[model samples]
Target: METSTFVKEIAERFSVINRLHPTELLLPLLREIAKGSPVSRKTLATVLDWPADRVAAALDQVPSTEYDDDGNIVGYGLTLRETPHTFEIDGQRLYTWCALDVLIFPALLGRSAYVSSRCPTTGEEVSLTVAPDGLHRLEPASAVVSLVRPNASSDIRCSFCCHVHFFASAAAADDWVAQHEGA
Candidate 1:
């Protein structure tokens, strides 16, 4: 077969490989590819229990690969770097890989309290006024924060991070705060 034909076949095979919805697996695959080695379609097909032609079809469909000016395939695939706007709250950062931290502050505050920052992490851009006190000031204040949120309706929760750590509505937080004033 001609060089161009061979390359085209490789591209097609790659497109088929993409059918695996291979996302998080990208890093490991890229690292292996970077070792100055070539990966065989057969190997991937065996691992995925897919036909080689299917793999090639998936790869050909993807525009993610790189090609030379002459339209020859050069490389394929990339690795995951980072997600946009990963959030941090109350000195702790939320991660996709782990279970979420329990929301303990609001229940502790009991009555209510007002937060200026929209929220601890989601950045939802909400404003809440709580009454009485979540925990009656049982915990000493070290750093007080205000509003922050990812977007609108964030007004319902932490304005910044957008985490619905608390279970009260804007009116609820307000009512609680108002009812237990000076407590």
Candidate 2:
């Protein structure tokens, strides 16, 4: 398959897996699952293939964490809810918006609830608010600004999260804020 097609497919899968599991073990879990599936392993290893011994070694290394008891091979992954669906590198990136809450806060100084940039964990933009003592944890962007109500007038797409807040550089975020003051 073409690289972009594969990447997009992987990204979609990652977003699914991430809904259940945390991000740290996403790749390892992917490798473990890939090893068993007939086409899944072959397709993934086609480009990002690893040596057989290396794959075995990595699989062995995956269970070393202290959180879950390491007895069954099938258990112990990035699960937050039930058994986790392992994610590949692409999956990890797809779920990154879920993890980058604090990272995107600076860009979210002035945000709205309806915009796609709100954090899923908090259901709002991760923003600083005045506390009785001083600055504390952030509130979701939604709490700050009401989202534009969906209506027949606008074409709205539902996504896992609203706006994405990745940065090539912090200076770039600064530039973005400077250029789009009310955006």
Candidate 3:
């Protein structure tokens, strides 16, 4: 598929996932998580100005929400924990579940980010600055992002996010795409 087509498809699939949950709360929750700290339910409720029970119920609809030992949210799509994809904003280091999250979150949070991730095949680092408007300072100009169609019934983190990655170049991703059989 063409690059634009692939991007559109991936975006659409994620949009579907978003529609399955309460985005009114999810978007703000994501912004809070992006602050590079684990967010407690009480804190989230206060920040959102919603009831604690309402916050708890909304959180239940979001899958793959990583929590700290104290039950504080550490990650959803954007996270405080370490991952292959590193996203830095406002001098704070953070992570994302996948390469696309690095691209997607900037617009969602209305902020720019410096991103770095290793190519799964070449083990070479792929780095870039992504703004709410577009990508910038992408090293290795030929760098590309890998994507997969997510299975709606499965956990998005495992089925889709884990497979999506940054590649140093198209050639570096060819073997991985071949092995994955539909990326």
> Who wins the lDDT comparison?
3
97-132 in candidate 2: lDDT tens per residue? 222222332232222111123332233333333222
Look at candidate 1 and tell me the lDDT of residue 8.
Answer: 66
Question: Measured by TM-score, how close is model 3 to the native structure?
Answer: 0.90
Tens-digit lDDT string for candidate 1 (9-77):
545543544453344334333333333334566654555567878656645554444344544333343
TM-scores of all predicted structures = 0.24, 0.22, 0.90
What lDDT score belongs to each candidate, Candidate 1 first?
0.34, 0.32, 0.87
**Best-to-worst ranking by TM-score:** 3, 1, 2
Model 1 RMSD to the real structure? 20.6
RMSD of 2: 17.3
Q: How many clashing pairs per prediction, in order?
A: 60, 10, 0
The better candidate by lDDT, 1 or 2, is 1
